[model samples]
Target: MGDEAGTANQGAPNAGVSKSVSVRELVNRLKLEVIVGEEALDRPIRRSKVHRPGLEFAGYYDFFPIEHVQVLGKKEITYLHKLTHQERDERIGNVVKYHPPCFVVTWNQDGLEYLTAHCRKEGIPLLRTPQTTTEFMMLADGYLMKQLAPEIQVHGVCVTVAGTGILLRGRSGIGKSETALALIRRGHRLVADDAVVLKKVNPQVLLGTHNGTTREFLALRSVGLMNVVRVYGRGAFQDETRIVLDIELVPWKENELYNDLQLEPQTSEYMGVRVPCIQIPLQPGRDVAALIEAAAHNWYLQTQGYSAADEFMRRLQQQ
Candidate 1:
């Protein structure tokens, strides 16, 4: 499906950069109630890790991550209630002095007058939610991770063949789009065409999606731009996919060697994550689309602990 809101921006300076999420965005996304410092909702959340200030409430502030969103649950609130007024004020005051992005009170825990007062004085956002501490932390952490993840723009075509995500990379006019269209006709789904936005969501996962305004649209040289959803229906498109394989197309050279056996696996790194890679030579008579489909199937087999090249070698040794 085409996403008008998720349109890719080719000229954006921050397209591939790590981004910060505003406390206002978080508040709206999580449906949190603004307890105090409504004006401070513009504060930026730079870290994805949520913190529970139990130690801070106990008057221990060593190695505190003030940039993280602080959470106050039943345990922390109960302990704070046990403390004297001066002790509670001093502890909360010490935390608010650092001016964290925000403080979120979870499980509808009340008795936050001290927290609200300190936050209002320091212009720090104080938010409340009905979700439990664990649930809220998980939701907030997941949202922050996706928003603050490192991303990069790649010039290629991304498609899902069978069940694997494949990225087609090559120079201009190398038939990347044409191959993707062919794959779509073969019951595959197109993730993105032209420019692909790759986000490193974690240490081991790189997500691929269409870059602004170009989602579900494919450019086929002489055929011009075609809306994939209009031509192939909704089943032929996907919003995003986890990239697992990269296949680079190059013009066939008579003297150059090619990996016909595919005995040695290749990999390409994007934003610090490496994905399985292969290079295919383009020729006038070669069916590049079918080759890509085969590659995808082979990738799936490898993931299932079956390698065709290894099997071929084992058979050869037996012969």
Candidate 2:
């Protein structure tokens, strides 16, 4: 989760201020400053490296402010030199071409007057830090500050058991837990909930899960909170999952435009990964557990080159 090798002893002042943010959001704030002290950039901003401020810590920053990048003064910035004009031009090109940075950062204490004037002219937010690069990175990583791809919860567990990953996604309060509980009861393992962290392990492989604890936990509205690990034992908690198939649960609607009762399951798209999805609409009295088992069974069949949806469509073609 974070770098805990050493702690920041008698740390310097902190520059962070508060603004409501997720880990993903914080990384975006830092990256906005294309020009960070090279030494600072070399380190990280995750939580592990950065310790809480004190004699052994740098103290706490409220949070990152609206101004994205935090700048370190030259006295504060060491091991970083002025970028060559050519390098500056190239970096600037990248910045303008892809994403506009909020401001410039530097390591020159003497250059503060110059930086101030330039920032004012450019109208970008500016920040100063004294804790140096290494500490900043440790802190950032510990905070879980990393950019995220678009996230969507698939309706079920994506297991690596057979190599084809499955994603289970459903609306809030739709008994996703209840269904997952049944799957686990049937010997299927648990993965993540509320949010799933996915990384591009490779082109064909993706790692998905809640940080080990998220899966072994469930939140139920009617009965209050329950413990998955205590109730189901350690077999229920999975370290991670491979993503392949995504199942989405939708509530059944009588509205003609809102309903799709076709036997064929529809496909949904996200972050360029296309997955076979089962659209199970919720009803007051429907067998959800049976439906999910059937979906997994259906997925297994698809792996073996048999598709119930295709067969249903083929029958219509013949008719």
Which candidate comes out best when scored by TM-score?
Answer: 1
Q: How close is candidate 2 to the true structure, as a TM-score?
A: 0.46
Residue-wise lDDT of candidate 1 within 97-147, one digit each (tens)? 988999999998887888878888999988999999999999998889877
**Best prediction by lDDT:** 1
lDDT agreement with native, every candidate: 0.85, 0.48
Every model's TM-score: 0.87, 0.46
On residues 1-319, what C-alpha lDDT tens digit does candidate 2 reach at each position?
Answer: 0011001111221225222233224435444332333222322222222222111112223442322333343322222235554543443333222212233333323444443444444443344434345555454443442222223333333433333355666556777777767766766666675556554333455556674455567666687666667988887667676666666667787863644435454554443444455666788888876776766666788779987667888999999
Which portions of model 2 miss their true places by more than 4 Å? 1-165, 212-215, 255-265, 309-319
Model 1 TM-score? 0.87
Candidate 1 structure lDDT: 0.85
RMSD after CA superposition, every candidate: 5.5, 15.4
